[model samples]
Target: MSDNTKAYLHIYCAKNIIVDEQKFSELEHIKGDDLEDVIKVSTDKHIVTANYDLPSNSVFNSRIKAKDISISCPLLEAGKHYVISIYEVTPEVAATEESTFMDYVHAEEIEKGYSICLYRKK
Candidate 1:
């Protein structure tokens, strides 16, 4: 894909394993100490999409919006501890694994018209 290509990803992060449990519900269950810690970090739509080519060592700050709540992402860095989940919205190819994050986790088609792929940073 070209550099201008924009891919839609439902980005999420948490202080604990609650986010992982939701992403990989079919896998072996993961237990977390507190369910309240599983706060939705941020969605791709909230951030600036123009800065897509972030350097490997670059660090930036952003906000996380969950429902009526909005807060900082806390020293957000590129290619750090993050799990990216991609939803196939169309049959046409828009982005690839190389242009995005790393570590292919799992992918599944929940129904005939819906599909999702998960990737974890290495």
Candidate 2:
């Protein structure tokens, strides 16, 4: 991939990931110890992080997974769809009539159960 090409790294099997500031700031939790930590956003890396204090109803989701709740829909390409394994993320849920979060995600197929994914934007 060219240096100019943007990469979405989302690994979930590592520690102290070396991601950019936006990625680190996009962490699902850090709101409260009583909140549920779930995968919610896409980043340059696949190494997702979350605590076990998230709500039981909210799960990090994407359109590719359930189509019910997923912000990653914009990440999907037109004809170059690759199978990546998406881990289950249960984050804090919104109270309004419309939830402000994507709390469910499923990978069509993952890299040996790994959480790293790379797809060109279409």
Measured by lDDT, the strongest candidate is 1
Candidate 2 lDDT by residue in tens digits, 1-122? 11223333333223332222334444442222223222234323333322212123325642222211112323432233222223332222111113233222332222232222222323
* Model 2 / residue 74 / CA error / Å: 7.7
Error of 2 at 47 (Å): 11
Q: Where does the lowest 10-residue lDDT sum fall in candidate 1?
A: 46-55
lDDT of 1 by residue, 83-114 (tens): 33324432122223454446444444433332
Runs of candidate 2 exceeding 4 Å displacement: 1-10, 18-20, 23-26, 30-37, 42-122
lDDT of each: 0.31, 0.28
Q: Can you tell me which runs of candidate 1 are displaced by over 4 Å? A: 1-86, 89-96
Which residue pairs in model 1 clash with each other?
Answer: none
